[model samples]
Target: MQFDLNRITRKNIQLLKPYSSARDEFSGEAKVFLDANENSLGSPLTKWYNRYPDPHHVQLRNKIAAIKGIAPEHIFLGNGSDECIDVLFRCFCEPGVSNTIICPPTYGMYQVSANINNVAIQEAPLLPDYQLNLAHIEQLVNADSRIIWLCSPNNPTGNLMNLEDIETVLNNFFGLVVVDEAYINFARQRSLISLLPDYPNLVVLQTLSKAWGLAGLRIGMAFAGMAIVEIMNKVKPPYNISEPAQELALKALDEVGQVNDMITLLVDMREALAAVFRQMPWVEVVYPSDANFLLVKMQQAHLVYEFLLDKGIVVRDRSRVELCDNCLRITIGTEQENTLLVDALAAWHEQ
Candidate 1:
């Protein structure tokens, strides 16, 4: 498909002049700094923090580029994936005029971000089997449809959307196709990042929050064509990523081997937990998962959720969510923690 970013982008954003920061103005090595109005005296906690973080995340993006096998120019850093979602809406969806499509029983943030940006939403609910409804999606696309959000190893469903289905949308859609891969680290499927050369409209979002265990750092990444990356950079705040966050992420990225080991362990625990649940008479179904969590349909699932809560164990009650009736979403915890959960569930089963 010929994806004309200019055709889809909001007019104001296309013509907008981005804010120039003190850091953006200077690039050479400098011993003395007078520009950003930092105190001559250093900060109380850390001397380095007195100065502003890099407005562009140059160093961090380079590090991530090396890891993801992409050029630094293709990456856009955000405070979190939430920020990326909101920025996409601002850049592409003109408020009230432009609309985006989302498959139901997917991530809640996509709809939340769209609503916050005053962008109309069109629903294309997932099929009964938890895959994209391509025909329904195609029907919903109109001239104003600027984005279609897909979640892989999807949030509540915990299964990757079929690769063929995703490519069909990318092949057909004229506007941007955003594939949020928050749980990609756990999935066996290859990320859509490699397809950037083929699809200019494809925007792949990943995060340090999941496998890297850096949720508190609030770092999210959006990989897209240079055009989309440039627009996202223009819309984001000057210092969307803090100096500490950048530093911590840099350190974490160096430990890929360790993270991979943890991922293996989590996957093991997830399967073990699922096996135990499968044997339980109370568990109606233990949905297949490519993510860190499991979506389980059980007898009186809400009561089971309450029972676990009363014992100080918490799991998501997704019974109210579409296609997940009488279901609970459970994240795979450490071995000991998983044992505690199983013990609690066994007790509930006995009751």
Candidate 2:
């Protein structure tokens, strides 16, 4: 279908003249700097952090573009994907008027962000198989529906949403389609990032927190058409990502091979953990996962969750979530951690 970004983008945002920083206007290395009002005497910490970081994140975006096969202009790096998510609400959804649709038993942040922005959120719960309910989604969409959030290899569910269903939404929906791939590194399916060229309204988000082991760094990626990226940049803080985050992200990019090896190990561990869970009579279901975690349906899930907690073992109790009754979301931990969890469950079963 025809996707006109102007139709959904907030009128005030379209006319907004974003705040420009000193670094935004200048480039090239300099020996003595006296630009944006700094201490100039250098910071107390080793290595000068006296100056503000590059607001545009030039080097980080270029490195990411080279790896992802997208232009730097198409990338918008946020403090975390949360920033990008919030900015989208600010840029498109008009508070108390324009609304967004989200598939439930998915991520919670989408709903939280919508609430914070005062945008109405329409719920289209996933099918029993944990796939998109496209018909319901279509019925929910209206003139004021500005965005639709889909989480593949979905959180707490640990399964990828069917691609055909996603494509159908993109092909039919006039509003933007945001596909969050936070756990894509562990998934077998290819990222929808490659399809950005084919779908102008598509926005794919990924993060460094999971596979890269950089949760502390808090850098997230948003890949889209240059138009979307530019709009996001306009709405984002001038210096959202810190200097340390940019430096570490660049270093992590250099070690892609190491990251790949870690992913392979985690996938193996995920399957191994699933195998062990299947043997337990108490485990009613060990849902197949394209993620680094598993959603296990157990008998007396609340009791089991408490038992594990009492043993100093932690797992999310998602039994109250719709369609995930009696379920606990378990992360693929190290071998020792996994052994501890398994042993704890075994002991509980014995009792």
Candidate 3:
């Protein structure tokens, strides 16, 4: 399934001229930076933050490209994966003319972004078990469908959609297939990133927020053929990533071991907590998790949720979300935090 790689995306985007800053015109070692006006005296707060940052965030991209084994050109850094997701709809889907296919009981932002873009949405709800309904999805897509939104180990479900199912979509859909892997790092499944080169229509979304513990940094990375990336790069704010975020994320990358240790702790906590939740009589089921969170089904979900809130423990109430009735989404916190949650639930059940 080869796409024109060079073709297909919005026409307005191709003819658009991106604002060029002095920094945009140059890269590599420079003696004295006289680019986008910044205090040469340096900020009183931080010397490193004196200047305006690279619009393209090349350094951060290189670091990520090295880690992900892809060229920096194939990457587009956004304020968050949300931004990239939004931009994709903005760039490709023509308002009132094109639509996107989303599997609901999945991520809400996909629908939100599409709505904001004024792009129509075609729903293909996940099967009862929280897997893609490939047959239904195929039926929903039309000539106007320009994007197919997917979330692996999906947001509320905590389950991975079969890889083959996703591949089938990519192979069949002529539109851009945006696979949101925001939670991929926590999962053992191989990222859809590797499939980018194989499917030009593939766009894999990732972020530093989850695995790297840099949510405040708000850095989201998207990998696709350079063509799609270039289009997004043109549309995003010149300095989408603030200076401090770039610095912190880059430094965080340096301490890769620390990040791994944190993930290991969280993964261990996730498993331990899963076991505890399952043991509770009120807990009907604890969905398997590959991400930092768990989606749990309980007999008295609403009552338990209110009780936990009363105890100052906050977790998502996904009960009203389709296919997740009476389910509560819980993120694996520190060891002590998990203990508090477990104890709270146990006490609530006893009451």
Angstrom error of the Cα, residue 311, model 3: value is 0.6
Task: Write model 2 residue lDDT over 1-351, tens digit each, in one string.
Answer: 367999889999999999988887766788877888989888889988888999999999999999998899999999888888999899989999999999999989999999999999999999999999999999999989999999998998999999999999999999999999999999999999889989999999999988888989989899999998999899999989999889989999999999999999999999999999999999999999998899999999999999999999989999999999999999999989999999999999999
Off-target runs (Cα >4 Å) in candidate 1 are: 46-48
User: Per-residue lDDT for 1-351 in model 3, tens only?
Assistant: 345533456778778898887777876688898876777777668455877788978789999999899999999999999999998987888888889899988889999998998998899999998889999999997777889999997998888889999999999998899899988878889898888778989999999989898899999989999888989988898888998899889988988888888888888889989998888887898999999999999987888889999999999999988899999999998888888999898888778
Off by over 4 Å in 2: none
Better of 1 and 3 by TM-score: 1
Each model's RMSD to truth, in Å? 1.0, 1.1, 1.8
**TM-score of each prediction:** 0.98, 0.98, 0.95
Candidate 2 residue 130 Cα shift, in angstroms, is 0.3
* Per-candidate local distance difference test: 0.94, 0.93, 0.88
Whole-model lDDT, model 3: 0.88
TM-score of 3: 0.95
2 versus 3: better TM-score goes to: 2
Instruction: Report how far residue 61 has shifted in candidate 1, in Å.
Output: 0.6
